[model samples]
Target chain A: MPDTTTQPLVRVIAAKKDYPLGHRIVQALRGVTLDIASHSFVVMQGPSGSGKTTLLNLIGGIDQPTAGSVFVAGQDTSKLGDSELSRFRAQRLGFVFQNFNLIPVLSAAENIEYPLRLNKVPAPEARARALAMLASMGLSEEAHQRPAELSGGQCQRVAVGRALVTRPDLVIADEPTANLDSATGAKIIELMREMRDRLGTTFLISTHDPQVAALAERMLMMRDGLLCDA
Target chain B: MTSWSLAFRNVWRNTRRSSATMIAIALSCAGLMLFGGYIYWAHLAAEIHTVVLSGHLQVFKSGFKAKGSGNPAAYALANYDEIKKLLLADPVLGPKIDLVTGQLMVNGIITSAEQQTSSTFAGVGAFPDEIERVIYWNPYGLTEARQIPANKHLFARKPELDAADPEGITIGEGLARLLEVSGDSRASLELTALTPAGGLPNMLSATVRQTSIRAMEEIDNHLVVMPITMANDLVFPGEPMHVTAVQLLLKHTEDLHTVEQRIDELAREHQLDIEHRSGWDLNPNHERSLNMLDMFFAFSFCIVGVVLVFTIYNTMMMSIVERTREIGAMRTMGVTRHGIVTMFLQESVVLGLFGGLAGVVTGLVAAWCINHSMILYTPPYFNVKAKLELMCLHSPMIIVGSFFSSFTVAMIGAYIPARHASRMEIAEALRH
Candidate 1:
């Protein structure tokens, strides 16, 4: 067993989020608490407007809770300044979105190399790592192709490769497979599970697909700004 | 991908927009360059014209500028040959001097006996070959005043005062008109002046050799140019050679100030009462006109620069709006706000380089065409027309400055938009 397995990669405690919408306050999360163990695959399933994304954003350090603290990779995310938060996210957290979010101007391999470049990695090493990641993803032949040239499944795979190429402590994937078809989405989920198993990197995914949820080691649910057991 | 390569690629993401932005940059650069070239032409025109009329520097007896017009005889420097020898042998000025000559300015009554007309006249007496060099000093190959066909008679190529014809005189067209005498070789005239020592009357006679126009109408109406021997004999009768002013033409006009300083030192050493004027100082109107043009150039550059700034700003803003989501992705990947701004500024640098290069090439080509076309223009106070030419090649700073201005304007325009893009809420930008 990995030494990090004993400690959780993420901790959320009584996080409360509220914002004024026009004239009224909308509570997106209310005193929610959670933990995600290192090297574990976790999933949060919720319907639209059920605050799953809001909670994920809180854990991602992109949004702060109104009355709580969240820790990721051993640092209190809410206490970090904007630049520090950016660095924290860049070094410790990875994100996979529903839209794939590939830079259209860059090729598949270049897209995978983007995060490494951000981490101040040298160009030759970054390219080597990106190419290695592409081979591991079984898309080496399509390395030079742009995101537009790739199918929906290949783009999601490239996004996943990009997320894991930096080998961060945790990958926060919100609807990573939403844009792909069922078979493609299943392959993408399988790819992520394989990455987690091989690299010992923790994953916190949000999904509505029960099939994807069935493969998670731990499952949580959110509705009306509160969390519940699956 | 490296940030620079990424930025370069992003600059071309919207080809049409990028091209349009670059075109705006290029047009502004070319326009500024052309205008600067014209200003360069004006500078040269003023310098050469001043040199042609007065040499690079003229040394006058002290107080001549204040009172010499009323009594030039009193202000005339005595022992002209000695002063000329001293000027030619001086350590500081000897090597720099291209030509050293003396002129006698005399005013008296002139009579055209055959025409039965007489008029008060202002006369200049000078060495034929040396004064000819001063009048035809076109170092920059400016349109020669005498060479213009329309000015052929006005600026007759032959020496104005010939040594062979000791009694010959060249008179201004206005003066000849007043005397009712053409530039006929047979036109006879007599001049009368007072001897300096006792105010005794003295007279000399000459035949009209040519009639030419002067730049200033007031001077042209009563002007006479004759050999120095006749002038000295007419004004001082039995005295040695005396000169109202010594004209010094230098090999390089840039040496005028230094030579003037040395002349001042020489004056003090010899205890000679002398004052000097540069070609630039002699032509006040030309200096004022150039100053006005300089002001216009400054105003033009500001207006053009501001417009270019807004143009680049608008272009950058549009690109940023289109790439909001992309910015969010990079931010999430740990790109700092400074990093994001750097990327966009790099794009502007590319725009500046390519656009500036294209603009310089276009400006040069356009300037060459205009210079070759031989377009004609008559400047203010000039009776002869000159070729309208742009001196772009002759002035390199204008090229570099125009290019740099475009680059700087593009950067200024991109800065605000780049900063705005960097400040976008990461999650919100992702949502967009």
Candidate 2:
């Protein structure tokens, strides 16, 4: 496909994260290493506490590991301070979740524009971008509706629109289809895959759903916080 | 796209919680403001009393205030014409003096034909024309001068007093009531006081000409206003001299500060003893009222602070817990701990702003309603009657202070929650 070889957008190396659970330390991740190609649709699958979500978090730079390094777009996430990392997240990353965490008070259009606003994007431009994203997601008529007014599928659709509206370098989706029914779940995966194919936007999703795994071009299976198969 | 928009959204998300918090803040501020306004009004009223009744600066004999006894006419300025001419000629002090009048405080027993009130009265013999100039200082002068509604008619100019009749007196309505007399018609009243001549005590009989009201009932009820000539005749008999203190009224009361200093300098230059007293100093109750108000304001501020902290704390705690997964997702999406903190803080400030704005409107309206409706105030040690006052209407400080306090309290309340939000671990947060 059109000379699709490019530098990796995310690089994880020997990442380790430990959490204190009462008396014993729980190792959430243990020395996992991998490189995600630019614009690749990657899926990570594991049971609860298997570090699939942890891997996603490390890649996203939301949490720092006890030991290890994560680089997104060649910038080491561990080296950035809290504020800088936040700016990096706003400027370069987007996220989607199974719960479709749309702010309850904001309408669809406002939800999509939230990140842009946080990044201090000019109001008119942010509005135009949000409206365009809403229309693209078949939510043009529902722009003013809040999350409570939308159905599961519509909320998820709006969530996806919000995640991609900023046109970030990477999109992190953690069990995005877990809350939806099979049919609605499939539609969400289809929409995500469409975005990957059309916009060349890279996606890294953590899930145990076979339906979601089937749609990923690159599948990563994890066991006990370690990568078992790729 | 600004952080404020997000904060605004958060504010609207929990309407009940926000409204409760807002009301608490607004009511506290409004209460403080209204009470503060009352104290201010009382203080102002007292000041008007002092300035209008007593004058800003009084020129007296060297030891007149301390030892002149009740006969201030004893220390009457000898070079009266020269001093008046000098004062009237000074460019700096001339225009600043709104009204320059002379007052002669004398002790006399007011007696009416049918009723004999053998109580001590201070005969405030004043120059009719010049006294009106100085009368600018007294707001309740005419009102308290006479309590009987019908006696209000007596404040009108009396031809007898203006004609330099030696027997003309304008007694307080309370004094008139005490003397068992009325202000409208002429009546013979016996004025008995020691004459300043040779420090001998003398008695004179004067006709009741006019009357006035004053808040200080004692001063009004016993006051006998005789012509300077007549007062001089009865006290200093046949002496071409009169005046206890040279009263100086100012155009603007606030200009007292400037004029007070200038007058002191003038008094020093003329080798005269002129003591300056502000309206506040003369009314001890005004100072006490101000102190009590300040204490109330401080107490209210503390209450507002506590309420704000709790309010923001509750909201942020709930938000942090409810959005655990979202926060985790956001963190994974490259949002840092600081970003999380800022996001939550922004939400708090927004909440504060919205609530504060609502509170300002509510407070102003409530204050207006309360003021217009007429609250009853029955201060002790006085007549048993409810007084009506619009405490908040005329004072601008209360309005502005209340507004700023709300916003500040909101910001203060957001601080801890925002810090806690920033400290969350993305991995742990997501798991929850």
Candidate 2: give the TM-score of chain A: 0.96
DockQ scores of the candidates: 0.75, 0.47
Candidate 2 per-residue lDDT over residues A1-230, each given as its tens digit: 11224547888889998888999999989889888998899999988889887788888877788898888888898898777888888888888887787877778998898788767888898999999999988999999999999999999999998889888889999899999999999999999999988888899998878999998899998889898886
lDDT of 1: 0.88
lDDT of 1 at A35: 84
Off by over 4 Å in 1: A1-7, A20-26, B108-121, B147-153, B173-186, B192-203, B213-223
Report iRMS values in order: 1.0, 2.7
Candidate 2 CAPRI classification by DockQ = acceptable
Instruction: Report the number of the highest-DockQ candidate.
Output: 1
